[model samples]
Target: MAAPLDLDQLQTFVMICDTGSFTRAADEVHRTQSAVSMQMRRLEERIGKSLFEKDGRSNRLTEEGERLLSYARRLLHLNRETLAAFDDRSLEGQIRIGTPDDYADRFLPEIMARFARSNPRVELTVICEPTPGLVEHIKRGNLDLALVTHNDARQSEVVRREPLLWVTSANHATHEREILPMAFGRPNCVWRRSACDVLDRMHRDYRVLFTSFSATVIAAAVLSGLALSVLPECALRPGMRVLGESDGFGLLPDCKIGIMRGHTANSEIVEALARHIAESLDNISVPSAEEAPAFDLAALSAMRGRRHKPANLMPGW
Candidate 1:
């Protein structure tokens, strides 16, 4: 039988990948640089893969290293979770969590508040990427938990549902245009596909005015009279008006919110956080009567003017 991979070596591998220096990784992990190199050599022999190759003055991950990274991260995460689960003491580690940009503003505050209060010792690191990106993160063990827009094929827990609404600026008549101009997510966004499919069926003359992965970017366009957009109920901001069948818009299917967890997300605190997320979303009495906080036009304009754009979606996303 093949020998099991060493947790210590895997941790070293991940540390080297993160810090981008063998010497730095050795210092952090309390090992001599030669010992670190030896660990990597043993790991390569065990896996029969050349994980890294020297490039000029630095070492870069070989294709095999990239593949092993995901597995290494998962194994390390699961090991930590397992130890934490068996311990009698309160959980005390950082949890990496993820959500779509659209859900971050609407759902995170309350959920984060609840989790922090309940698990004071546990640290939370949040990542805001779209659903497909979050899925990739989960697969790569970059995130321990994720809240995603649920669909039939995704392997996640559907925790809540809300209407997908057509929204326009209350102060603008953008939706009334003869050829409807719309702001939408990338082509793979489920909401974008739905909106496009409905428009095609109705033979509605519509053109995509803006394409972005950031919900806020799209929301800015919607609120500034730049275009119309379809967003889930929670994404509605103040000064946005909903369009319905009465406004010549077709019906859209309900949006389902889901929770994605690491394959080995069995730690007590992880489960506790999942419960908090579900309870928070289920108790929507707080947000139902009000819109999420809005970014004013000036702020959004500045955001657009910045050279830094939102992260690009992964390939095939």
Candidate 2:
């Protein structure tokens, strides 16, 4: 029988495909250029097919090599995951996770701090974006997990919905803008939609005075008394106060927080990570109605509308 395929040889092959140069691949794998060529020749002999085709001065994967590259990536991923699982609590593997920016700053830091207190060996890669982008990454398997606000068809078995709260300046009279000016995020943002829908349903005429995807910009707008914003209660701070709770305003729908697992049984690192996240959120002090801001519709409807709604208010939306 043919000798079992060598993992080192397959890895070298992948490096060659990545760099498109045996010399460069050799430098990366710490082998001589001739040694690298010899390894590839042996790999092709064992597999019964040439791995690459030489065209002019460039090297490209042969049809068979292209097919092998896919399996090579899978094998690498599986091998890494398996080793991580067998290793002790020293969870020293790369984890790519995505979440909304609001959560990244307000919620994730605390969770990560707590997790790191225990698993100092683990390395984390975090990407902060809106729900749509995060979901796309999860579907592409580029992210090990993501936290997103649940939407209609995007809702999954791995989702958790957190209550969203409407927040405005402390006193309606202090901020004398009749048309409840809103500081909004991109259209895909659930918080922005919730804020707009609440105003529309109540027959409140409002204008989005400032728009941005950055949480800092939205927070700054609200703090400067330029506009009001809807955010999670836990996200509120002294600079940005909540509206009154006794104003009889309708509460917006809960913001969905999802935790997706790309591989359920592949690695304990993922499970430990999920567990750490859950515990972190569970221990947080969620905002209650008493802590929510008050809203006055009669006062809000008095402001004037913008000259125009500003066409294409959201660029990518």
Candidate 3:
């Protein structure tokens, strides 16, 4: 039989595609850039095809690389699941998790569900808070793990870096108004700070029309055309339009979603949960700029027609 493909190399391949650069992929896998490059070269030689091609200063996946991505993700997930199945069942503890409402709604359900299924006795206490507060909670030992948005590259293991978009309801003319009206979370919210800072730097006049800790409430405000808000690409709904420079809104910085752990988070359970979070994020297919038009207002209206109701709000939990 042919020798089995290495899972570690497969993971490196997937990371390279996800991050869009060999350097970023190296940072993610905690390997030197040369090491990652060598590994990929070997992988290509073994498979007898090029996996990547130079696209300017960055790398783009070749056709073969694209086909292998899905298979690699499935293989990694199955490998982890199989290992977890044989893990010691005696591991049990209450794990306190903190995350922003946006991430909670988008990624937490599946993460928590899989964790619960695998470790039935491990109790989960999830807290919904802004990223700053979540970090503080982790530092104060109030949370075992936290998913936060930070601009600092050295903060934690970055799961994803999504472009921050200025979104408004397609039916609403809020973006056309003078002195842009904005809706955002309360103080200490990263998106709120980022929006305000950019507007200030650009000398743009804007007013805070609504403030809510709940993402659903903010979505409702935007959906009703009450105000425009800055959100990550993943948080955008089908019917929401992304504003750009042409739309009179300056570019916003990308939001880095990272996994943070408390000082006391040294248990196997904590590590397992972290792995799950990373894997879940890795599996998400973020659209490339070329694939998505900056302002596709026509499609927005269609998406709005079938928008699903927001998940249950978990404020101050």
Candidate 3, residues 1-317: lDDT per residue as tens digits?
87788889999988876676777778999999899988988888877888777655545677787778778987878776767667885458888888888888778877887777667668989999887788778878888889888666437778777678788887778888878889998876778989999999978889998999888888888888889998886677655677777667777777789998887744677887888788778676544444445445443333333343232121110
Candidate 1 lDDT tens digits, 34-100? 9998999999999999988766555778878978977887677557555655566856777888999
- In model 2, the runs with Cα more than 4 Å from the true position are 1-90, 156-161, 171-176, 244-248, 263-266, 287-317
How large is the C-alpha RMSD of every model relative to the true structure? 16.9, 18.5, 9.5
The lDDT leader among the candidates is 1
TM-score of 1: 0.63
User: What overall lDDT goes with each candidate model?
Assistant: 0.79, 0.67, 0.77
Per-prediction TM-score? 0.63, 0.58, 0.73
Top TM-score model: 3
Worst 10 residues of 1 by lDDT: 308-317
lDDT of 2 at 113: 74
Residue 234, candidate 2: alpha-carbon lDDT: 51
Error of 2 at 308 (Å): 41
Candidate with more favorable, higher TM-score: 1 or 3: 3
Q: List the residue pairs that clash in candidate 3.
A: none
